[model samples]
Every structure is written in C-alpha cells, then in structure tokens.
Target: MRPVDEHVAHAVSLMAPVDLDEVALAEAFGRVLARTVTARYDSPRFDNSAMDGYAVRAAEVTVGTRMRVAADIPAGSGEPPALHSGTCARIMTGAPVPHGADAVIPVEHTDAATAEVTFYQSAVTGAHIRRAGEDARAGDAVVAAGQLLGAWQLSAAASAGHATVAVRRRPVVAVLATGDELVDPGMEPGPGQIVDSNSTLLSMLVTAVGGVPVVLPRCPDRPGAVAAALAGVDADLIVTAGGASVGAYDPVKADLAGHGVEFFAVAMQPGKPQGLGTVNGIPIACLPGNPVSVAVTFHVVVGPMLRALLGAVEPKVLAAPAAEGWKCPAGRAQFVPAVVESDGSVRPATGGGSRSHLVASLAAGRVLAVVPAEVEQVYAGDTVGIMTSILENMG
Candidate 1:
C-alpha cells in the first residue's frame, strides 16, 4: 500500500476544475468564481462630501470669514451647484462637492443663514472630502477568479456593477455504505446489527465541501446486492464506506475490479483499507467502514479532491501547531481530533484515538492535529498542522 501522503498526492493528481456557469450575484455565496470581476466605474464616482457641512474653498474658511450660501446638496440628490467666490453650499454626507470647492467646513462649525455662514475653524485643502476612485479605479480587476464568493465578494460585485458572477458548478457525489449488518437510523437491529452512519456522514461531508451528495442505499455484504448498489448511480465522485478491506465478505474491492475501477489503498490507521478509482470516467473514492476511519479518510482524501474539482488552484492541507503532547504509533500517520483553543492551544478530545469511533470528537474538533509516523511524541508548543473547521464560515 502507498503511504497515506502518497495516496492523497495520487488522488489530487486526478482532480480538475468543474465546468463554469454564471449565477446571480445574490446567489453566488459559497461558490467559487470562474471569471475575474472588474470595476465598471470608479468607486465614489466623483469627489463627494464625507460629512454634512458647508462646501467651500479652503482659502476662504478663515476664522470669522463669512461666505454666501450658494445651494444645498443632499445625498442622492441631482447635480450640485457650483460655488462662487467667497461662497459655500449646504452639503450632506455623500453629496457631491461642487466645482470651485476644495474643502468642507462641518455644519456644526458654521452659523447657518441664506446670506452667509460664519466659520468657527480654519479649513485645509481636501478636508472632509472623498476623492473620486479612491476605493477602486474603473476597469480595475476587483475580484480575481477562483475566489470563493461570500457576502463581501457579493457586495464587491454589486459595487462593481455586476449583478451576477461566473462560478464553477458544484460537483455531484454519490455515497454508498456496504455491510449486511448495518441498518439505517431508528431501525430495530437484530443481534449483530449496527446503525448505518457512514452514508449520512459522507452526505454531510460532501455538502460541506460544496458538492451535491446522492446517497445510495446500503449495499449488503453479499456479492450480488453489492454489485447492484454500485451500479445505476450518476455522479462525478462515488464513495463507498466499507467492503474495501481484505475480509472474505468485503465485496467492494472485487466489485470495483469487475467494473474496471482503478486507484485503491494506502497505509493509515483505522483506515488502511480504502479505494480510489474511476467508474465510467467518474472519480470514485472508496473509504473505510469504521465511523472514525470514514471521517478521517473523507477529510484527508475526498475533501481536497472535491475542492480541486471546484477549481482550487493550490489545494493543500493547512497545518497548525500541536498544543499538547501526542504520541504516534510507528508505521502509519495519524489524524487526532483536537480543539484549537482561541489562544492556539490544541487539546485532544476525551476519546483517546482512532479506534474510539468518537464521532462526537469530530464535532468537537475545530482542527486536526496530524501526527506523522516517525514522530513518537508531539510536545506542547510544537507546530503541527490543523484542518480548519468547514462549518465555521458557512454562508
């Protein structure tokens, strides 16, 4: 079997960007942009007021200097009136500063009247004024392609005069769980039965990574039933949670071989039995059956592949420092569920290790403290890698 890292590297090599489509800017949240967005017009458009005040020439706003009131310009109003010599106009916030005015004396600093307003303070050139194009110039690329759109990106598009954006289409993934002893939640299980959780977990994981998940029913341990379940699913990525191991009843390994599936296996704890292949040119990642094993493999293998399919240019795992001591068993890398404290501390959750099947530990983790095979002990203050929480910033 390939080392865990090498297996992931091979899986990543097969990834490619999905096709693109234009979606309304309002509907673009959580989607990756397929094209660059440029500014249609200069931000601020023209010089405007930053405060409700009297717009006047900075040379004219001396103490006790009185200037004739020209015209009032409120925000969102029509064209402003030009300021005559020794004159000022009543300007509200965001109103365009009229020609011949280089400064704004706040209304609070001036006495109001039709004839003239008395200034209580001196004014400087360009005071309280927003310069045209200060935020962005016209035709400038504001948002680059491949950026995942969020509220800020949508607002930027709206500010740039774009009502919609071209984004990569979400990839479709199919999930199947194999085991005759497994049953769906709420089913009364016979003596050897267990609840089927891999399907649900895989579905949620696929959705979290921006893929559409189609969960196929559990494939029984029997060969015929397993083969039937593997067929008839249309998906870009197919995931099966069990039957990849060397066990006699493990049928997924043989089933995929019969259907000509490729790519399989790696050396990793609680998840050594895994598969990755293509069925009819669609990518398939067959994860392991153990719940914790399923979670780890999905995040390590399928998660990055899905993002790659959505056009993430430099797809790679982001690591964080390990805040506490962690021991790694030799020969296989380990992914430990950890809570990344606000102060950068990583605490392993109550469940001890991979065999614990502590799915709750997965929920409690904001990061994963990865321990390499060669490392016997990860000490406090050591910088290990962390996988960021997918639920932290949902749109």
Candidate 2:
C-alpha cells in the first residue's frame, strides 16, 4: 500500500496548471489572480478631504474666526483656485483640497453656511486630509499573484485602476460515479439498489474548490461502461467514485486498468482504495465507493489537484488538542470526520468512528482530524492536526 502523502503528491503531479485569461473585474470574483496587480495611480489620487468641511490654512484659522467661503468644492470637481489669506474653500468629503490649503475643519466644527462660514474651533495642520499615495503609490503591488480575488481584493484591484484582471481559468472537472446498484436521486430504489448521491457530493466538492464540475451520466459495472461514458469528454480532470477497490464488480478498475489509470491501496483509513492517472491527456482519480471515503479522498487528493490547477496554495492544517479519545486503524492513517469546538479542541463528528459508510454523520463534520499511521489511538488533550476546506474558510 502507498502512503497517503505519497499518493497525494503523485495525484497532484498528474495535473497541469490551467491557462490564464484576462477577465473583467465584474466576473473575477472567486478567481485566482495570474499576475501581480500594480497600481496605475496613487490611492486617493490626490490630497483630499476625509470629511465635509472647510479647507483652510492651519496658522490662519483660530477659534471664533470668521472666514469668507471663497469657493465651494464638491467631490469630483476639477482643481479649484488657491485659498486666499483670509478665505477658505468649502470642501466636501473625498474632494481634493484646494492649493495652498493645509488643513480642514469639519462642517460640524463650524457654523454651517454656504457664503460665509464661522469656525468655532481652530484648525490643525494636516488634519482630516487624505494624502496622495498614503494607501498605495503608483506601480506598487496592490494584489499579488495566486491570491483569490474576493470582494476586498477586487475592490483593491479596481482602486489600482484595473478594469480587468488576469486570472487562471477555472478547471473543468468531469465527475463520474460508477456502480451497478446505483440509481438517480429522487427515484425510489429497488431491492439491492441505492440512491446515487456521490455524483452530487463530488460535483459540489469540485465546485467548492473553484473547479467547474461536469457531472456525467452514471456508468454501470459492465465490461466497457466506464470507458464508454468518458470517451471524448472535455475536462481537465476526471473524478470517479466507486469501483476503485478489489471487488469483482469494480468496473472502474476493470475498464480503465490498462488504459492509463493505476489503482492503489493508500495507507489511510476510510479512504484507502484510490486511483491516480490520466486518460487521453486528461487526469483521472478513481476513489472508493463509500461516501465518507469519497469526502476524505477528495479533500486530501482531488481538491488539492483542483487548487493546483487554479494556481492556488494548498489548504492549511492547524494543530489542536483532542477533546476526546478515539481508536485508529492499525497500519493506516486515520482521517476522522471531526469538528472543532468553540474551545478550540477537536473531536469526532460522530460516535461511530471513521467508518467509511457512515454517510448521514458526515454532514456534521467541518474538518478532518488527521492522525499518523503509527498513532494507535488519540487520547484526550492530545494534539492532533486538523484540515479544513479551503473554500469554507476563504474570505
């Protein structure tokens, strides 16, 4: 059996990075940036007022001083005339301060007037003024490469004068769930048959990792059904659930064995049966049949592959103390569907342990508590490594 880390590294090596495309900022949300974005101009662009007030010379303004409002400067107006010795400019928030003016007294600090304004408070130098390049200067790196373009990042890119950003194209993933005993969801199952929820699960997982999932039709456990279902399909990666084990009716192994897919028994509990290879230039990953196994394998293997295609960094694993004890598989690493409590401790999401077939209990899991193969059991207060979904914690 192959080690889990070796299998994951091998699986990720099979995928190539997706091509980059220049997309409009409106459509760049959730996309990974392909290049570093630089500022075309300074942030705030010029010296502007941070508040709606009068732009004045600091040394000229005093308490109870009455100055004539020589000009009204609203936001978006062009350069205004310079401030005279005994006069000030009525400047609104975000409006550029007039030339020769070094301070701004907020409107609330003075009597609200249009033609003639009286200052009840003295003005301080450099007060309430947003200086040019204060946040960022021209040509400065605003957003670095490989950063996911969220609302905040996109806004910064826009403020850097970018109408469109170069981003990695989302990888197209074809999800195939193969099993003779499977039926479409929402249909009543007959004897010896079950609902096919793996397709939905895998598709959602692919999408959550920033990949576009193309859910293929269910392939049966027939001689050439797996090959026939994936023939001429257009996708960067192919993910197949079920039929990866050593069962007699495992069609994914039976059909794609000689055609580029190499099956393996990974050293991990709840997700040991795995396959990693490519089919006709497209990468393919065949996972175990159980729902929990699919969840675990996708997170450890397939999800990382998708992220790699998008030029994204891998998910982070945080170490936390175990809230309770749990037995682990003898020689296989354990990936228990677990939850992080409010106290920052980790525990199994269900009492049933890491049983692969425990589908219903998988929903309660928010993270995977990873244990090494040598660790026979996790005692309470023992430090354990927990892995979270990349998209779940992305902001």
Candidate 3:
C-alpha cells in the first residue's frame, strides 16, 4: 500500500497549471494572478483632500481667523487656481488640493459658511491631505503573481489603474459518480439502493476550490460504462467516485486499469481505494464509494490538484488542540471530518467519528483532522493538524 503523502503527491503531479489569460477586472475575482500587477500611476493619483474642509496655508491660519473662500473644489474638478495669501479653497473629500495649500481645517472646526469661512481652530501643515504616491508609487508591484484575486486585491488592482489583469484560467473539472445501486437525488431509493449524493458532493467541492464543475452522467457498474461516459469529454481533470475498490462490480477499476489509471491502496482510512491517471488525455481521479471518503479524498488529493491548476498555493495546515478523544486506524492515516471551535479547539463534527458513510456530518465539518498512520489514538487536548476547507479561507 502506498503512503497517504505519496498518493497525494502522485495525484498532484498529474495536473499542470492552466494557461494565463487576460481578463477584465470585473471578471477576475477568485482567479489567481499569473503576472505581477504594477501600479500604472501613483496611488492617490494626486495630492487630494482626505476630508471635506478648507485647504489653507497653515502659517496663515489661527483661531478665529476668517479667510475668503476663493473657490469650490469638489472631487474630479480639474486643477484649481493656485491659492494666494489669505485665501482658501472649499475642498471636498478626494478633491485635489490647490497649489500652495499645505493644510486643511475640517468644516466641523469652523463656522459652516461657504463664501467667507471662519476657522475656530488652528490648522496644521499637511493635515487631512492624501499625498500622491503615499500608498504606492508608479511601477511598484501592487499585486504579486500567484495571489488569488479577491475583493481587496481587485480593489487594489483597480486603484493601481488596472482595468484588466492577467490571471490563470479556472480549471474545468468533469465529475462522474459510478454505482448500479445509485439513483439521482430527490428520488426515493428502492430497497438495496441509495441516492447518488457523491455527484453533488464532488461538484460542489470542485466549485469551492475554484474549478468549474461539469457533472457527467452517472455511470453504472457494467463493463465499458465508465469508459463510454468519459469518451470525447473535454476537461482539465475528471473525478469519479465509486468502483475503484477490489470488488467484482468495480467498473472504474476494470475499464481504466490498463489504460494508464493505477489503483492503489493508500494508507488512509475511509479513503484507501484511490485511482489516478489519464483517460483520453484528461487526468482522472477515482475515489472510494462512501460520501465521507469522497469529502476526505477531495481535500487530501483532488483539492490540491485543482489549486495547482489555478496557480494557487495549498492551504496551510493548522494545529489545534483536540476538544475530545478519538481512535484512529492502525497503520493507515485517518482524515476525520471535524470542526474547529471558536476557541481554536477541534472536535469531531459527528458522534460517529471517521465513519465513511456519515454524509450528514460533512455539512457541519469545517476542517479535516489529519492523524498520522502510527498514531493510534488522540486524547483530549492533544494537538492535531487540520486541513481547512478552501471556502473557509477565501477572502
């Protein structure tokens, strides 16, 4: 049997980062930047007012000093006339400060008169002013390459004068669920049958990791079904659940065995049956049948692959104290769907710990509590490594 880390590394090796493409800033959210974004112009663009007040020369202003409001300067107004002595500009926030104006007294600190404003407080030079390039300078790197574009990153990119950015294209993932005993969700399952929840689970997981999920038609256990459904399909990766085990009815193992897909007994509980290879030039990953196994394998193997394709770094594993104790599978690594509490302690999401078929527990799980193969038990308050979901860490 292969070690868990070996399988994860092998699976990720099958994927390559997608090509870089220029996309509009509006459509670049959640995408990874392929190139470093530099500032086109100085941040703040120009010397502007940080507050709605009168722009004045500090040396000329004192308590009770009345100055003539020479001009009104609202935002976007171009180049007001230079301020002469004993004169001030009524400047709104974000308005460019007039030349020779070194200070701004907020409106609250003066009489609310526009034409002839009276200041009750003294002015300080450079107060309430946003100097050009204060935040960043032109040609400075604003957003580094490989950074995921989010609201804040996008805002910075736009503020740096970028209308479009070069980012890695999102990967298109094809998801297929196999099992003769499975039916589509919402339909009542007959005796000895179950709903095909793995499809929905895999699809949602794929999307959460920044991949476009194309849910393929469900495949049965019959010969050639898995291969036929995958024929002529176009995708960056193919993920299939079920039929990779050593069962007589495992079609995924049967059909794709000699065609480059290698099945392995990974040293991990609930997700030991793993298959990874290419089918028709598209990388395919076959996970175990159970829903919990699907979730675990997605985090351990598939999520990293999708992240790699997007030029995204894998999420850092956090170490937190276990809120309770649990047993682990001997000689096989365990990934228990668990929740990290607000107090930074971790606990199982369900009472049935590490059960592969506990589908409902997945909804409550925020992270996967990873245990080494040699560790047989986790006592209360013992520190454990956790792999958080990508959705939880997205900004």
Candidate 4:
C-alpha cells in the first residue's frame, strides 16, 4: 500500500515530453509552444486612424480653425494623398494616417467635403493615432516556449506573421479495456455481463486533456490475451481499465510483468486496486474496472502522467471543495464525485459504490473531491482537495 501522491509522482517521473512538430496556426490551439514566438512585424505596422476622422497636422487645428479635405483614405487601400499644409484627409478606421498628418480629429468633431473640412474643436498631436508597435514590436517575444495556445494567442501569432507554430507533440495513448464481464455498449451481453463504458468515457477525457486515445480490441479474462495486447499495442502510453485487482481473472498485472513492466500501485479506496507499469518502454496505466474508480484514478493519477508525457511545463491537479460531509476510512484515500457551483462552491454528487459503474454521476460532476488518508473527518467549507474539470476556474 503506497500513498496516492507517491503514485502520482512516480507516474509523472516515468513519462517524458513527446517530440516537437510545426503545425498550422489553426491546429496549434491547446498545444504547448515548443519554441519562443517572436513578432515578425509590429502590430499596426504603421500609424493608423483609430476612428472615422480627419487626419490633419496638429499645428493647423487652432481653436475653431478649418482646413480643406485633400483625399479620402479608406481601410485596406494602400495609398492616400499626402496631407499638404493647412489640409486634411478623410480617414476611416484602420486606414493609415496620411503623411504629414500629426493628429486625427474624429468625424463627430469635423464636417467634411471633397475639397474642404470644418474642425469643431482643436486637436492634440498624436491624437487618435495608434502608433506602430504599440501592441507588439518586430522581433519582440510574443509568446514563450511551454505556453499553451489559446484563441487570442493564435490570432496574435497570425497577426505577427506566424503561419505555423512549433508545439510539443501530443502523446498517442492506446486504451485496452479488460475483463470478460465487460461488453460493448451497443451489443447484447450474456448473464452477469456489463456494458463497457470505461473506454468510451476515458477516450473523451483523454482527448480533452490533450492526449490522443487509441481504442484497442478488448482483452479477455485470460492472461495470454492481456499479454499479447500489451505487447502488440504501439503507443507512447497504454491505459487499461480493468484486471488490476487481486481477483483470479486479474491478468493485467502478471501479463505486464511478463513484458518487464515496472511500476507500483497506491492504497486508496474505490480506486485502491490499480496498476502503473511500462511494457516495451511504453508507460501503462492499469485502472480499476469500476466506473467511478477509473474516472477518479484518471483524474488524480493518470492525467498528470499524460501532461508530463506531452511536455507540459506545469502539470496541474484539478481541485475543488468537497460536495458534502465525508468520513474517511482508516487507511485509504477516498475520491467522491461533486458538483462545482458557479459561486466556487463544491457539493457531492451521487453514485459511489466500487462495483457500480455509474458514469452519469461523472458527467454531472465538475470536480473530483479528494479525501486523503490522513483525514478522518471532512465537513463543508473545510478546504478539501479538489480536481476541477474547469481548468481555468481551478485557480
């Protein structure tokens, strides 16, 4: 029996980041940057009008002074007549301010004509002009390595002339759901058979965490099939959702051992019987068959390992508050499904038996409330450990 944190640490340490690849800007979102992204050109590139206005020399706009309109500059048109002495140009939003124009008086403040314009107010130098490089300068660092790309970041990168981005490769994980009692959800099962939801549920979760999920053929209760599957699957990581316990049919442990897999298990309830090993140098996470058990173990134990394998700079645990009062048994860590409310509060969700493979509770839950082995009693608002699905709100 080992501590849960120790198990997590071991899994993370055993994994390494995948290689880097250059992907199109559209495909780079949610991937960690493998190299620093510097700006190729300054944003705004040149001084431009911030609104529909008259671009004129600041010196010409004395109190109530009027100037003639020389030309119109609409956005995206390359050229506009240069501003002459005592003259202005009709400039639209994002249009480059004409040369020799030092200020922009908004259209609301000026009346315009093809050859003349009336300024209702004085203008200050550099007014309403977005200077070049105001947002980002050429060669300036826009994004650093190891940073996760968001929509806004991608847009900025594109604007700065990055058509493709180098990001840490997403790990390919092969999923093998074991157990003879487990049956595909769409198929009819014999007596004592159960639907196989672990693979389906876990695959989505893995993709959500930025890991690739490969569903392999189900392995039977026999050790031979488990060993063959473990040996034959090709992936950076392998996840099996059953046959990790001490049952007679639990062949995952012995099969992985035959392949020289190395790892340990943690002492925790509902998820106590789990395994972590490596077959053919590929990390293997053998999870319990119970629905809630596998989900909790994935969140607490496997998620971090996946991130580490993907080269995430900081592998974070999803945490929130406990949903309800919890009493910890003598020795094992307890994981309970809980709803994380909008107000940053957490409350328990139903379905917690080890044998009951209830995925509905997991779908409704926003967090996984954790009760450590040292904790004997837990009450509401006690600041318990939490693993939140809303990664942004976890902070």
Q: In model 1, what are the clashing residue pairs, if there are any?
A: 319-385, 319-386, 320-384, 320-385, 320-386, 321-384, 322-384
Between candidates 1 and 4, which one is better according to TM-score? 1
Candidate 4 lDDT over residue span 92-161, tens digit each = 9999988899999988886655577778899899999999889998999998787678887788789889
lDDT scores of the candidates, listed in order: 0.80, 0.91, 0.91, 0.79
lDDT of 3 by residue, 195-251 (tens): 999998888888777789999998989999999999999999999999999999999
Question: For this target, which candidate reaches the highest lDDT against the unseen true structure?
Answer: 3
Cα TM-score of candidate 1: 0.88
Number of the top candidate by TM-score? 3
lDDT of 2 by residue, 85-151 (tens): 8899999999999999999999999998989899999999999999999999999999999877899
Off by over 4 Å in 2: 60-66, 115-122, 319-325, 343-346, 379-383, 390-395
Instruction: Report residue 234 deviation for candidate 3 (angstroms).
Output: 2.9
Please, what are the lDDT tens digits per residue for candidate 1 over residues 55-109?
A: 9999877888887887889998977878888778999999999999999988888
Superposed by TM-score, candidate 3 places the C-alpha of residue 181 at a distance from the truth, in angstroms, of 1.3
TM-score winner, 3 or 4: 3
Per-residue error (Å), model 1, residue 214: 1.0
Model 1: how far residue 228 lies from native, Å: 1.7
RMSD of each: 2.8, 2.7, 2.5, 3.7
